[model samples]
Structure formats: C-alpha cells, structure tokens
Target chain A: MDKKRKYPYFIENPLEHDRVRRFLDIFSAILETSNYRYILDLYSRVTMKCSRCASECQIYQATNDPKDIPCHRTSILLKIYKRHFTLGGWLKAKFTGGSGLTEKDIDEMLESYWNCTGCGRCVLYCPLGIDHRIILRLGRYILSEMGIVPKNLLVSTREQLQGETHNSSKVPLKALQNTVEFLEEEIEEIKGVKVKYPIDVYDAEYIFFTPVSDYLVEPDTLMGIACVLHEANISWTIGGTNCDGVNYGLFYSDSILGDVNRSLISELRRLRAKKILIGECGHAYRAIKDFLPTYNDGEKIEVVSIMELTLQLIEEGKIQLDKNVIKEKITYHDPCNIVRQNRGIEEPRKIIRSFINDFVELKSHGQYGLCCGGGGGTVAVDETNPYRMNVAGKMKAEEIKASGADIIITPCANCKKQIGELIQFNKLPMRHAGLHDLIFEAIIMKDGKKHGTDD
Target chain B: MAQMIDFFMKPFFIFSVSVMILGLLRLFIKTIIEIRRVIKTAGDKDFKYTKIFMATLSWIIPGKNTVNTAVVYSIVSFVFHIGLILVPVFLMEHIIIWKGAFGFGWPALGKQAADVLTVITILSGIILLGYRLFSKQRRKLSSVHDYLFLILILVIFISGYFLPKTYSPFNVQVNMLIHIVCGNLILIILPFTRLAHCILYPLLRLASAVAWHFPPNAGKELNKLLYGEENKKI
Candidate 1:
C-alpha cells in the first residue's frame, strides 16, 4: 500500500498540498490569535514524564501500548506545538532546519488522538492536573476543520447544523410530534391515564431539550419523563424547532458546537420558556447546563438536568414510586460528562435507588467510573468500533460482567447505545436501561393504575 | 589554566545568577499576566486560595497521593528531590562558597550527613535515569532533553563529590571546572526546559483551572470557559 493511503482518517501530508497547507496555516493562526490562550499555556507546560496517567487510562491498560498513554498521545500534538509555536522550537528550526512537522507526524496524530474517547479519566490522576481530553478535543477541532472527521460525526453534525430538521437524525417536527403522540397513546392504554408530550406550548415554565434519537431509538425514557412531569404538574414543552440538545461540536468542532448551542437558545427564547430542563442525555445535559451559559451570555434562562427535577419532585413527595417494581440486581453506569464533568453523580444514583431494591455497584463507579467506551462521539463513529470494543470498552465490560447485574441503568443516551451494544457484542447477561426507564417502571402515577392495564 | 579558571569564575557566577533570575522572572510574569487576563475575561473572579494552597502542598509532600498509585517511582523521586535541596542549601562546602561570594552564610549540615545525602541524591538520579531508559512507557515519552538534563545533574553531583577528595585519575582543576560549568549551564537552562517545573508547579496550581478547586459560582465560570460554557449566552 502507498504510504499516502496509510492513514485514511487524516489528510495526507497536509503541508505538502497547497489547499491543506493553507487550511493548516489559517487554523494555526486562528488558534494563535483566538480563545486558545489557555490551551496554549497548558501544552507549553513541561510534561513531568511520570507515566502516572498510563495506569489510569483504560486504553493503555487494555493495549499495554506506551503510545496509548494519555501524555504520550498528547505529546504528539505538543511536539507540533514546540516545533511551530515556541521560542526554543523556533531557534532549533533556525539552526537545525529539522523541527518542522512532516506528513508522518500528522498521520500519527490522527491515529492517536482519534483513538482516545476523550473520557478524561487521566485528569483525575495527573499530579499537574493536565486535562488531556482538551487536547483531544482541540485535535478533533483542527481535524474537523480540515474535513477529516469521522463519517458519522461529520454527517450527523452537518445535518444537525444545516439540515431541514436541525437534528442529527433529521427527524422533522411532524415526525417528532407523531412520536410523542404515539408515546402518549401507548402510556394511556397501558396505565389508563392520559399524559401530554407537549410540543411548543407557549410560556411553559420548562423547555425540555433532548436528543432527537429519543423520539426514535427508545421512547421508554421519554414516557418516564412525561409521567414524572404530569404527576408533578410542571409546565414543560419540547420546542418545535431545535429540540435537539446535543452539541456534537462538544465532540469534534467548536464552530458547530457554537452554532448548535446558539440555535437551541434561539428556540428557547422563541418558546418564551423560563428554564431549560435537559432530559437524560449526558452530553446534551452538559452542553446546555454547562456549555450553554458560557456560550450565550445575557440569556438569563436557568438550565438544569432532569435528574435534579426528578430528585426535587421525589423529595417533595410529588413523585411516588412502588420501589418493588425492580427486583433484579441492577448496576448504574455513570456517564463521564454527568458524573465527572457535570457533578450529577449522586442525583442519578438517588433516582435509581428510589425504584431498585437490588442495586449492585460496579467496582469502578462515580467520578472514576470507566467510560462506556463510546464517549466523545466514538459511539457515533463506526470506523473505530473494533478499537472501542477490544480496547476502550474491555475494562468496562469486565466490570459490568463481574457485577453480575441483570440490568444496567445509565442516564446518558451515548452510554445507553454504547453499553447496550457492548452487552450484545461481549455476550454479557446484563441489559441496558435509562434511569428514566427504571423510573418509568416504578413511579406510581396519580390515576391509581399501573402500566399494562387497559381502561 | 588556573588563571583562566579564576578569571572566568567571577563573570560566570554573575552570568549564571543573571540568567536564572531574569529567565524565571520572565516566565513568572508571563504566566501570571496570562492567567489574570484569562480569569478577568472568561474565568471566575473568586479563587479558593486555601484549596490552591492545600493542593500545592499535598503534591509537594512525599507519600500523599503518588504513593497510592506510583509507589516505587514516587519514593525514589521524593528522596532524590529532598536530598537535592538539602545538600545544596546545607552542605558546608556550598555554604562556604556562598559566604565567600556574598558575605552571608547559614549553619551548614555536618559533613557525615552531607555525605549520606549526597550519596542518596546521586543514587536517586541514577535510578530515575535507569527507570526512564528501561521502562518502555517512560522511554517512549523521554526525549533528548530528558536524558541530557539527567546526565547534567549526575555530572554535577559526581564531580562535586570527588572535589573534596584527592583523586588522581584526572586533573582536580579540570574536574572542578566541569562541575562549575555543568552547574552554571543547568542554571541558565532551568527556566527554558522541563526544569521549569521546579518553579512553575506551584504557580500552575494557583493559576490553572485544572489545578484549582473553587466555589460553586467560580466553578460555573470555570466550567463555562474551560468547558466551552462561556461561548454561549448565560
């Protein structure tokens, strides 16, 4: 095979081609002049070279490859920084003329940076507290700008940004409304109660934002959320436009992330919603609750997680649960963005314990929980599944299998899809559930009827 | 040759001092300014000084956190760093040199204690170097500067250790010159190389968001900026 064709994920010998080189030069200049000052400071710091992060990285632990170590993985980009950005690097280039990045170096970065799930477990153990995940994100931004992103992420993000539906799945408002109506009818038939999956209700207190996939892939969580809101009598509505809370730019591109987030804010403003109630999608929750406030200042809308709402409702006695509905040994998978990144660690577990009698804890749980191997958009990228399973997901699978749990509950949509697939691929006995799914099962609705009873 | 060595001694000492002070000042001012600018525009105004102090202190002390995960390497590194500081600050010979140069000196460590510390420092440097070379993981991350810095420190220690004894294998004056030059070179490059960690570690703890644990509002600001929260309207 030609060396040019070796690394298909990245553009070949970027500096060798005029168009690619121009893009690199322009992007490099942008980074040099833009909001990347903090990142530049971070990369310029001396790596203590302790290899402390290797033991903490699941990828390195599984592969035993030094190159997979987070610091080593990041050092590839640091080397580029040193060669292009620093004074010593400049002097070395002046004297030796041997410090410029080559095509081979670009290829290596593409291979290493994408292999990481941006799970950020390494940040916990690093003595200097380097966030290697940011470097991976920066790498993704640069790569995405060069049109070298994974096919799935590129397609989804593009569709979400520029498509007619303004969602990655391209589910139109009609389809979304139809799905919500279907769930409403299904819930009514099962529980002998009528609930509204309200769409674009003006002046609602809460504007509910969730991934479009919730309307297609799994609606159990959606129904659970509807039941909780109905019982609590909260005025919430999903917007007709920009209902997607997912900002894929969180995974790959800053521009896309900004555009997607801004659009969501516009929708919220249009609906005249007072607060943004993000559903049980981890990255979506993070993008809205954490990233939204930063991106859209002066938008005084208070954004919060659904767990906070459910927990608050349960505490107020507005939401009641049977508690005995779930009897199997169940474990919870803490989504990286929620637990470590957003501090939703306890709330999700609290909601689960309300319904589950036999809750088994995975050995690695909470802030240090192993990633579901599908974080940072890896779940969306099909090109890396073999690596995700055999390497990134290995420790997580072993942890799940060892817990001997019959069901695993995760609040994050990405984790739901990733862990569900992992169970199928690894042949584990456990099935995956959303926290809302279990909550849907156990929560006592106000109409004095259980699910599956025809009126 | 002795005259030449004596002639260069004053200038070399002055040069090393100037380089060390100026280089460190530049690094410190730049880092502080950058941090302040970032915080003013994008980060939380309130900083948890106590948290920063504790986090820096925890990392400075030996056997706190590193002991749990990296036992052997942490122990060796801690011993080496402790000895490296103790010998330089307390050794009688170094104090005597300081007294001669600056007319100020402190009480020095006993000769026997200095000897033991010197040996420990030398051994630790060797062990650390060996670890870097032999451990495939570390070796992959190791660069030319890593090895060169280790070699420089070892030479400084080795030459200083023999400077007190009547060694005949090589010219004593030459050995003295090698020790002086290597030590001076280290001072000149200290701010430029990974050795800057010796000074910047604590500052990074205070200034960098990753290293600080702040109040809730501060955390929100930090999350907004570092996590792309500030890019949107709050």
Candidate 2:
C-alpha cells in the first residue's frame, strides 16, 4: 500500500465541526450562484496533462515536488471542482459514492494554492494558455469565504477596512502627519532642501497612494518620492482616507479586493484629485492601474505609476541626477505583478539606466525574470519564511549571487522585504534599495548639489 | 458476417459523429454565452481586442513565448497535433472510407507518408502516456479520464495501422472492426473529457484574455444571490 502524505494544517487541527459545516453550506451555495461553475467547466475540460508548465515553475524547481507545479497546483482545485460541481461527479457520487468535498480536500486546496504566488509566469509558458493565476485567486477567494486565510492578511485587511486609521497598518491621521513632518525634517537635514510631504491637499494635480508598508517600514522610499515631486514642483498629496494603496484583497479575497478598490475610488472622488499617483509598490500599482477599471463603472480617473512620472520628469529635465554618486554594481529584481502582469518591463530599466553606470542584468531578467519568491503575500505570512529562504528563495538567492551586484534594487515592497530576508538568510553581501532610493541618492538637488554632500 | 459489421458500424459511426458535433456545439454556445456575460458586465471596457488576437497568434506560431522554454516538448506536441488531423483526413485508407460514406473524397497522402504519419501519431500518444505516468507531477495532475483518452487514441492508431497490414494473429476484419469502434468512441467522448482542449482551446484562450480583465466586483452580483443581501458594497 502506498503511504499517503499528511498535510498538518488540515489534518492535525482540523477546522471545528460547525465551521466546516458552515463552510460547506456556503461553498456549495457559492458553487451554484457564481461564475465559478463556468470557471470549473473551463478548467476541467481545458487543462491536459502536457506537463510543459513544470519546466518554468520556480517552486517546482526549488522543491522538486510534483505538487508544486503550477498546473498540478491548479489541478488540485480542478479535481475538487470536478468531483463536487460537475454532472458526472454528481452521478458518480450518486452511484459509486465517496467523491464529495471533505475536510482533507479543504486542507489540500489551502496548502497547494497558498504555496503559489499567483504569478502569471506559468501562464506565459503554458502551451494551453491556462491562466493558473486566476484559478489560484478563485481558490484564495474560496478559502477566504471560509475564513481560512493567513491571520496576518486577514487582520491587516480588516484594519484597513474598518479601523479609524483608514490604512492597513492602522496609522492614524496624527501618526501620518508626524511621519511626514519627520520626513521633511530628515530631508532638510540630509539634502539641505525643505520638502513637504503633502497630505490631503485638495485639487492637487495627483493623489498619491502607496502601500502602507512604505509608510510603516520603507520610509526612505516615500522620502525619495517627496524629493522628486518637490524638485519637479508637481502638485500632489497622499490621500488621507485609505491612504494605503495596497489592496490585500488582490491577494486573498475578490470581495475584499473590490471593497478596497471601491474605497480608493471614493477617496479619489472626495479629494477631487485629477489623477491617482501610485508609489513604487507593484501590486498596489496593479490594483489601481490594472484592476480598478475592471471593477468600477465609468470612472474617468487616470492612474499613473510614479516610475512613469519619474521617467517623464527625467525626459523633461524637471529633475537632475548626478550619475556618479552611487558607483556600485546593481541588479534590478523585477516584481512579477509589475513586469510580467502589468507590462512594466521597460519603464524601470529605462529609469535604472539613467542613474546607474554599472548595472548588470540577472540571467532571468525582464519578462523571464524569476520571482523574488516573496510575492502573493508570502512575505506577509510568518510560517512560510523558512520555506521562502530554503526552498522557494533558493533559485532567487543563487540568481542574486551569480549576478555579483552589490546592491539589489526592488521596486516593490514585498520583494524588498522577501529579498531583503533572503539576503540575510543566505549571508549574501547584498543591500536592498527602492528604485527611487537610487534616484534619491543620485538626483542633484535644486542648489546643484548631490543629496549627501554639500561641496 | 458482412451484414452484421455494416449493422454495427454505420449506426455507431453516425451516432458518434452526431454526439461529437452536437456536444461540441453545446460546449461552444455555452462558452460563448459565458464570455458575452463576462464581457458585457465585468470586462475592462478599454481591453484591447487586437492584443488578444495578437497574443493568440503568438502562441499558435512556433518559437513564441510558450514554446521557447520547452522546445522539445512543444515541437513534438506541434508535430503530433498536425499528424493527428493529417492522418485521419488525408490517409488513403481514410479517404476511401470518407468517399464510401459521403460520396466524395479529397486527395490523399501517399502510402509511405500515411505510414510515417501514423507512426508519429502512435509514438506521440505513447510518449504523452509515458510522460503522464512517469512524471510524478503529471501523474498527480492527471485523472483516469486523461490516461483513458491517451490509451484510446493509441488503441485507435495501433488497430488502424494493423487493419491494412498484417501483424496480428487475429483476423484482419475483426481488427478493423475494433479500430472503427474505438475511433467512433473517441469522437463521441472527446468533447466531454480533457481532450476538449482540441475543440475549445481557441475560445478558452480568448476567454482568458477577457478573464484577465475580469472585474474585482464581478462576483458582487453573485455574492448577493448566494449569501443573501449583505451590504458589503463594492
């Protein structure tokens, strides 16, 4: 007899009976009423056993586990969809029995889908053109409905949704005001130029939105934005309501994703801001720039990534850079959401080229770039960090090592955190900086002096 | 004996073809309606149709994104798919049968070409089956239905090849009957199984483009219907 592998999250501390029952009830109901029936139908009938997708998958490359294959991961959900929702499945259950959704199935779905980063890299290489990312999102939505999401994502999203701070980090108005004030003082001290971090300035040309991570952890990235915008003299203000651009819903729940996006739209209307300016976060840019038009109706608001703005500013000579300031070999870590999913492959490279003299490409760069192994909220969950370092992060760490770049420029916050951790874990002598971090360091201030030196 | 073969063969062929046509049509219409629904309500209004077509065209041609990574598998798969249609439609033996049924036949490939293409089809089927069985990931993803479809195709190819040339101890006529029966069964079942990829691939690819732009609030209407009215409005 073959020994069956155990999944602890499902089997060891199984969901309470009532919760499982409630989940089953709601899930079964969802099966009937949603477009999932169509999705299930398409998935069950469309996917074949070609195994072409395995060669390109980073997770499978790391673990060598068949289950980590993108197609195989989606297959777990497909099997459940077939068994529970299809006509043949119903008939089989009626006659042969024992093919219904079980607690184990729930566990397996969670394990397989969560392990995936919802990256579209596999889709790019799948012969069938199956968007396994969509299927993974549907899986995440299914799990979120059952209240079976990572506690961190859930808490942060809830705080962003219901809390007074209007952002995931629960940063209140006063805290945000203080952070801005502090950032202004720091900028004045360092650059010898007083720049204001504009907050809720009505009729501003752009309403800037960034991931709360920037506000909480990556303050330097925000400061860089302040310097560029101030030097360019662009009228922009970070929104006060739902100032955080990161929609955790895009990761876990479509409803929450919708809710968060809707909140942003409402904020935009309230601010009467002409355009939405998203900072250097990848998924946040994806959520507003890529996702908002799909979800909302008749919104004429123009959403632009700050990278694009910076590039435009460079072309217009609105900002000047001292290209000799940061003389270190640097490699750019492409965030999957931005580069592959959102067609942002060239913008960052263009910006990077203008500032760095010794830039090198990773073996797998641009559209073919390997993920930093921290996407799709993997960086948010604590339990998966070891896996990130040892298994998923293995290829990425090697890629970084082989590139031989002293500094790694990550435009996305998640990549910064995850790659930052991978650097530490692998004991690699790599430093993490935002793309704007380099720009901030290199840009000549209005006084025609570099930021750190006054000579 | 000939009458019995005719009795079993003609009806089976017609029934299988009818099921193949009708089943595929239903799938096509259902998928179309689903697309229209999504496109009308939830799709990105600014979605580029040219981009969708261009993306589809890129995937269809060799040396594109999908084929660049797994060159061998994609080449073999492309060759096998071409042989799949070519052998069945253009083989001399198949043309004779088509003429007998429809009173018309197109030009057929020479015997040598038919033999080579048949061999390619059979080999591809076997390779696909072997891959499915040997690769732990492929095996895990595959269902019995997936394996059965490959085996059925292999059986058809093998039995069909043997019908014209003698390799079996059994009667050639009996072997021909088995080949015809299996071929018909495949036609009947293809649209229902994962082999539906054969017919549904193009539409699904386009649908994926639409789905890529599928709205975040696309499920909002469904949520109301499923969970009852709760005002977590998007």
Candidate 3:
C-alpha cells in the first residue's frame, strides 16, 4: 500500500463482495446500454484467429505466448460476447453447454487488457481492419465499471475530476503560479528573452494545457513552449483554474473520457477562447481533437497539438532555430496515440528534421512504429516498470538502440515518460526528451539575439 | 436421392439465397443505424467517410499493407476467395442450370479453368484450415465453428471438382448431391455465422470507427444508472 502517495485509489472497494457477479452485471449492462455493443457485436463476429496481428505486436514478440497474440487476447472477450449475448451463441450454449464469464476469465482479462498498451500497431495489420485496440479498451472500460483499474490511473483520474486541485498530478494553483514565475526567470537567464506564460487572459485566440507533471518535472519543455509561443506572438493562456491536459480516461472508460473532456472544454468556454492548444500529451490531444467529433457535433472550438502549432510557426517564419545546438544523433519516437490518430505524425517529424542536423528514423516509424510500452495507462502502474522495459517496451527500446542515436525526441508526455523508463531500466546510454526540449535549445529569437557564443 | 435433389434444389436455392441477401441487407442497415445513433447521440457527426472508404479498400485488398509474415496467408486467402466465388457463379454446369431455370445465362468459365480454380479453392481452403489447426496460438483462438466452417467450404469445393468428371469412386451423382447440399447449407449459414465476414468486413471497419465513440455525457449517464449519481471519477 506504500506506493506512489501522490495518487490514491480504492482498489479494495472493487473486490469487496461478490465481485464476479458485479463484473458480469456491469459487463451485460455495458454491452446492452453502452455504445460499445455495436462494435463488440461487429468485431466479435468478424475477428479471425489467423495470428496476423502477432507479426506487428511488440508484446507478442517478446513473450512469444499465445495469450500475447492480439487477436487471441481479443478473442477471449469476443468468445464471451458470443456465448452470452448473441442468439447463435445462446443456442450453442443451450445445446452444447458452452462456457460463460467466470473468475478465471476475469483474472486473465485483468492481466491481459492492462498489458496490451493499446499501441494499436496490430490493428493496422488486421486483415478485416478490426482494430482490436478498441475492443481491448472496451474490456478495460468494462473492468473499470467493476471499479477494476490500475490504482495510479484511477487515483489521478479521481484527483483531476474532483481533487483539491483541478489537475491529475494534484499540483495546487499556487504551485503552477510559482512554476511559471520560476520559468520566467529561467527563460530570461537562459535565452536572454522576456517570455511569459500568460494566465487567464480571456478571449485569447488560444488556451494551452499540458500534463501538470510536465509543468513540474519537465521545466525545459515548458520553457521551450513559453519561449516559442511568446516569440510567435500567438495569443494564448494557461488556465490555472484547470491546468492539466493529461486524460487517462482515453485509456480505460468512455464515460470518464467524455466527462474529462467536458471539464476541459468548459474551461475553454469559460475563457471564451477560439482555439485550445494541447502540449506534449498525445492522449490529451486525442481526448480533445479525435474524441470531440463523437462528443459534440463539431460545433465548438478548434483543438491543436503544440507540435502542430510549432510546425506552423516554423513554416510561417514566426520562429527561428539555431540547428547547430543539437549536435548529438537524434531520432523521433512516435507515440502510439498520436500516430494512430493520424493527426500529429508529420508535424513533429518536420519540426525535428528542420533543426536536428543528425536526425535518424527508427526501424519502424510513423504509423507503424513500436510502442514505448507506457501506453494504455501502463506507465502509471509503476510496479510494472520491469515488465514494460523487458517485454512491452522491448521492441521500441531495441529499435532506439539500433538507431544509435544519443537522444530520442518524444513528442508526447506519455512516450517521454515510458521511453525514459525504458532507457533507465535497459541501461541504455541514450536519453529521451520532448521535441520542445530540443526546441528550447535550438530556438533562436526571430529578429532578436542568437544563443551567441558570448554567453 | 435424385428425386430429393430435384425436388429440393430449386426451392432450397431460392430460400437460402434470399435469406443470405436479406440477412446481409439487414446487417448493413443495422450498421448504418448504429453508426448514426452513436454519432447523433454523441453530437459529433463529422467523420470522413471518404477517407474511411479509401482505408477500407487498403485492408480489404489482401497483400496491401500486410505484415511481412502474413503476406503468404493473405495471398492464399485471396486465392481461396477468388476461386470460391468464381467457380460457383461461372462454372458451365451452374450456368446451364441457370439457363434451364431462367432461360438465360451469362458467360461461363472454360472447363479447364473451372477445374483448375476448383482444385486451387479446395487446396487453399485446406491450407487455411491447416493454419488454424497447426498453430497453438491460432488453435487457442479457434472454435468448433472455425474448424467446421473451413471443412464445409472444402467439402463444397472438393465435391464441385468431382461433379465435373464423368466417373468417380461413388459416381458423379454422389458428388452432385454434396455440391448442392453443402452449397445450400453455406448459403443458409452465411449471414448467421462468421461466414458473414464475406460481406460484413467493410462494415466491420465502419463499426470500429463509430462504435467505440462516446455519446456526449456517456459516462455521466452510465454512472447515474449504476450508482444513482455520477462520481468524481469513473
């Protein structure tokens, strides 16, 4: 119980009494009432046992277990859906005594669904285009309904939605003010420029939200973001009232995903901002951008990744880079969430290639890249760090090593954290950073001072 | 047996083929309704159907963007599907039956090509089944239905191949009965079983696009239903 005290969870509450019954009840309700039924119904019927997804799954490659096979793992739930919900399955069960949901299936699900990472590479290779990632998420969402979730993710989600501070990391508004002040001074000292992280400026063209943890731990990324935005003269503010963009809901529950976005969008509405900019968080960006189409009728504000904004600024000649600041060999790690969504892929690569002189690509990059193993809320689990490094993250780690790059520029907070863990545990000499972290180094002021040798 | 085959063939084909067409139509209509409901309920209906259409084509075509290891299997599946559909519709015997019944028929495959296609269909169908039975991973995912379905298709193809010959171990009538009966059974089960994938595959893609989507306030509604109040966290 003496784990990360930053987050709190009611793990014991889910398994309190008659859990199997509760699980089945929730599962049945979710299937019937929730929108997942259509997908589950369709995928359950069409999903093949061909093991095609195995070729693309990093988890399967490492463990070489049949259970690790994406389709096989997905089949576990699909079989249950058929056995319990569909007419054919019901007939078969009545005649043949087919199995139903049980404690053993629950145990396997608890282990398998969480470990999936939901990187979604396998979905692309699915012959039927059955993105089992969604199905796995459906499984997790059902488990979440039973209150079965990783403690850290649930705690963080709880805090974001209802904690003392309106952020996942539980950082108070006072701390954000202090971090901004500290970064303001740090920017003046480091870049010889006066950059401000404007707060609560209503009617600004853009409002920015980054992972609250990055606000505290990744000061360099914040500084790069601040300096770039300041130089670009883009009207933006960080809403101290609701300052985090990390949505763990996207990994587990649709309802939570919607609820969290509703809260964020409310902040945007409150500010009366025309556009919302997300910083260095793929799922957060996806939560707002991709999920918005399904959440609303595309009526409201525009959502853009900081990478997209930065790429635009670079193209418009609003931001200048020194290109020589990054001498180390560099590769970009495409976060599964960003690339899979197909929105944030090209921007980060373009931005990295613009200034990174010694840039290299991973063995598999773009939409086909391996996962950092911290996807699907796995990084928040913490106890599974070893497994992530060895099995889940192994393919990405090996690819990074083989790329022989000294630095891996990860554009998403989750990938940065997960790949950081991969490097730490794998004992790889290389380090990883957000694209903005390098942007902080290579950014030269437009029509202002260069990072001159005199300093 | 000849009398039975004659008596049943016309009505059986009519009934089963009608069921197949209407069943797939029902599935299609249901899919569109579900997609619209999910979107309309969510309040976000701005999906790019054009892009989805293009993407559907990519994966629907075997060997396009396939994983290196799955290339052979995908190609084999492609071949099996081609022969499965082509031989049934284009065989001279089938066209002759169609002409006899409807008083008109389209072009038919030459005997040599039809024989070759039938032989390949049976062979590839076996390989596909072999793939499922051989791998522990695949076998674990397989069900009795999976095995039975492939075996059923192989039976149809093998019997169809023997039907064209003048002589066989059990005579051509035995193969004729199997080809007719097995083909009818497939048509009957096509929509009920995973065999529906032949038509449902594209809708499977659209379902994936639209299905996991959340209706606005989806979480709030579920929470209130379960606990009488939406919690701070789900």
Candidate 4:
C-alpha cells in the first residue's frame, strides 16, 4: 500500500513556525502594505455567488465537484477575508457563529487554488468582471508566504533566486553557451545559413529570454527564434545569469514574480537592450509584460513576445514562410496568459494561417479557449500529474480530439508541455508543438538558399 | 397613533436615505483615494477607462455585450434588479409619499406596470434565494446575512404587494408600517453589508485595475516586513 500521506500533500510547509499565525500575519501584512485590500474590499462585497462560473470552469466541469467551482474555491479565501478582515463579517461571526482563519482553510486553499490554470476564461462568463485567477493568485500568494508552496515550485524558485546557476533550471553558464551553439548548429543545418545567436553582444537592440527549459528541451524553438531574428535583422543578446524567462512566481508569490522579472530587467539594463524579448512561454510573457512595471520602479520596460515579434516580422514581409513545408492539419491552442491577459488572440493564428493550408480552429478558440490544465506551475509539481492529466486536462484533450488536427501549435511553453502530457496520457494520435517549432519547420531559409543547398 | 406613525415615517425615511447615500459616498471616496494611491505606488498606472466603461455597461444591460455565457441566471438577475430599483423609486404611491414629504415628485410609473415589475422582482428574488439555498456550492459560500438580506427584500416586496389588497389579515396601517420600516431597514444597512454591492458594483472593475498595479518594491517590503532582513524564511 502507498504510505499513508501526511497533511499538505500538495505543497511543502516546513511547519517550523506557527503556520496559522504566519498565515494571518502574512494576510494582514498584504492588506496593510499594498493596494490588495482595495480589491478584496470591493471583491468581498461584489461577489454574487450565482454559480455562473461553474459552466465555464474546465476543472469543475471534469471533476463535477463543487469545490472545483471557481466561486466556491475563491470563497475559501473571501470567507476568511470577510470573517477576519471586514467589520460586518467580524460582527456576524462574533454574534452568530462566525469563524477565524483555520489551518483547515489554508489546506483547502493549498488544494484548490493550484487546481485552476489561471485561465480567466470564467472572467468572460462572469457578469461582474471578477477575474478568479486574481483571487486565486492572492490565495496562492498568502499560502506561499506561509511557507506552504508546492515543493517543485518552491525548490525551482529557490534555485533560481538563490542558486549558483541563477535560473529555475540549473543550466550553468557553460550549458547555456552550449545550448546557444547547439541551436546555432541546428539553424545552420535547417536553413543552410548561420542564424545569429548573440550572447553578451553589448548595445544590442533587444535581449532574448526564453523558458530555460526550452534551452534544454526545445532546440527548434530557439533555432526558429534565431532564424526569424536573423532574417528580420533584429540584433538581440541574451545574458547568462538572468536569461530564464519562466516565472513560476506568477503561480504563487508576488515577491518571487517581482524578483524574477527584476532580475531579467536588471540584465536588460546591464546589456543596454532596448526591450526584453520573451520566448515561447505563457506565464513568462504575462509575468514580464504585465507585472514588470509594477515590480520594477514604475518604468514600463518595453516587452516584445517572440510570437508578437514573429507576427510583426511576417506582417512586415521581412521573413516569409513556405506553407507547403507543413502537410498536417494544425490547430492552435490559445494559452490563457497569452489570450486572456495579454490580449494576443490572433497574432499567432494570423502567423499560422499565413503558413498552413490545413489550419483548423478548435471547438472553442481565442479568449474562450480552454486551459491545458498544466498551468499555474502544476506541470512542475510531480504529484499533480494525475489531476493535470485527468481532471483539468480532459476538456482540452477532448477539444484537440474533436478538432481532428494532426498537430496542435501553441506558442506557450507550458501549454505545449501540458498538451504533450495529455497526448501521452490519453494515447492520442496527434502531436503538440510551439508556434516557433512550426515556424522553424516552415520558415523559408535566407534568399533561395534552401536548407539542403549547402548540405 | 396616526401622528406618531407619520412622525416615524418622515424622520426614519430621511435618516435612512441620508445614511445610505453618505455611507456609499464614503466608500466611493475610499475607492478614489485607492486609485490615487495606486497611481503613486503601483507599477502600471495606465487605466483602460473605455474598456471598463463598456464592460460595465454590458453588465448593466444584459441584452448588451455580456455574451450570455451564464444565460439563465444573468438574465433572471437582470430582470430582478429592474423592479428592485425601479418599483420603489417610480411607483405612484411611493412618489406620492415623496411628494407629500418633500413637496416634489417626478412622473410615477403606471400602476399596472409597477405591479407587474413588483411581482417580477419578488418572483426573481425567490428564484435567486432558491439558487443560493438549494445549491450546496452556493450554500457553502453564503452567510446567514445573505439569507436574511434576501428574505428582508422579499418581506418588503411581499408587504408592498399586499399593501393595496384590502383582503389582508393585517390592518392597512400595520401593512403600510411594515413596508415603510423594512424599506428603511435595508437602506440603513445597505453600506455595511454585501448589499452595498448596489453602490460598489459599477465601480468594481476599477478596483481590479488598481490591484494589478503593485507598489514599487512591494515584494521586498512585504518579505522584509514578514521575515526580517534576509530572504530567510521560505
């Protein structure tokens, strides 16, 4: 039999200090220090609890568990806020059996908040414009402060923030250099020309940061990025230490999110790059693009996502694609961070459509697109694979199955991983890849020098 | 007894309405102060006023841009709000009361239309209360306050509906007093409870806009405050 599990099976809480008191203190500190209280104050009042979000929540839909309902999950925190923070709730509980913050409630949040992919699809359905993910993040942030973070997330973030390699993945300077050279070689083999993979080239126009995992696992994406940048004449550089764009901080801690983005921006300012160019990761783009300004000293350091840049390059006729290069029917998966938050709805689709004849749309596309379920850093947590594959992953799996496409092209690294996992778990026939992965396959090499011309 | 009831009606009505408006004003002022605070402190200060305004409008009128994802409840809730606001302010007798007290009244709603709206409000309130009560999901999120507020509104509506009917068990003065007092009671407590959603709902999106705008070095500040100098804790 599997060993009887202890409490907090989801995240690693050291239990060294008083967890309950730490939770309340952190919760109080957040309200006192930031504008977070304003949102909570308004949110605690405006929530209608109509169960409208249930119809849209994929996890809730698959599990058929009310606990999975975004409103219900959000209420776990909102209830605590009402009881402890607000006057009405305090009076009610004082007189009529109201309760305080409990260890059990924290456990419920530990279990529930991560279950959401932070999709914000439910925001579209909600009449009040309440983004459940914002509440979800607040819940996750408080828990992380209480030292109740998924070991996978906490470990990786700890490694990135404190370790010698200075990245979530412990890719050393030598390994990053090796990854760059490897991508250069792959680009040369694929395009019959040397694609520019610049490193520490001072005063470059842009600085590139992809998910560090992409450096290890996604050579084609790095190669594709190089080829596109080379063809577009966009000079870019990558810093060694802070090159990782994957911010798992967005999933849990605001401080970590800020620190990660701050580390990247520190690199950009050091390298004197015009803007930070993020590679194919959903939350990475959102973390940097959306939160960087807040995290940094109120300077909206410009961000150009690889997808947006590629689309710009394509739209400007700087680089062209040969549609005949790809034969499979392809469908696009809109990463929630990209579509719902960043409003990057059609940039990838427009790029894909320009290059493929058999481009298919899923049953629900764009802002209404479902989550890959492996979001919120759930992909990193080894214990959640079953939940990611079965509960949250099923809707997206069914969508891909229904689309009848041979390949799914999502520009998000997280979505690609989740979709990859879904296919393996469900024994599906289709393939999943990043948008850049397809671009590398289909991008016409420089000026009629075909991939095989010099081979 | 008539003079005492009249005295109770005028003074209590004036007091409740004043408290309701001032309370809402105070909260709204807090929201504005929050906006200014976020401007000074938050990361991104750009406010998408057009998008927020349009989105707010869509929710205000369900036939607009809400896109009907929660088709049944939203539409029902919209119908519910219609009479919940309109019938009290626009009904002829209510206007007559206002005119009697304040020496001015606007055009009153037709009696037939007012009754129709009143019944619709009561029915939809029942549906909403049922929606809250029956769903185990909803019940878990609800408070006794939520239940009591709904029942209070229902009481006021039921009493208002029965006010004109002479076949009632209670005398006319008794029925009128119940309607008057319950209406004032809701107004008095409106800002303190979730019912303050009435004033805060339209301005809701702005709070989110402000929340995402974090103060400069907020993370570091919070961590330092929580865990001493170094990033020692977690």
Q: Highest DockQ: give the candidate number.
A: 3
Q: Candidate 1, which CAPRI tier?
A: acceptable
**TM-score of every candidate:** 0.89, 0.93, 0.95, 0.95
What clash count goes with each model? 17, 0, 4, 2
DockQ, computed on Cα atoms, for candidate 3: 0.63
Query: In CAPRI terms, where does candidate 3 land?
Result: medium
| Candidate models: Cα lDDT each | 0.77, 0.79, 0.81, 0.81
Report the poorest 10 consecutive residues by lDDT, candidate 2 chain A.
A5-14
lDDT accuracy of residue A167 in candidate 3: 90
Clashes of 4: 2
Each candidate's interface RMSD = 7.7, 3.2, 2.1, 2.1
User: lDDT per residue, candidate 1, B16-78, as tens digits?
Assistant: 867887988888787777776655554224456787678678877764566756678778888
Tell me the tens digit of each residue's lDDT in model 3 across A62-109.
Answer: 998989999987888887888877898899899988768887788788
Q: Candidate 2 clashing pairs? A: none
* Cα misplacement distance, residue A329 of candidate 3 (Å): 1.0
lDDT of 1 at B194: 76
lDDT of 2 by residue, A189-266 (tens): 778888988777888899989988787788788888888999999999888776898788888666777778888988
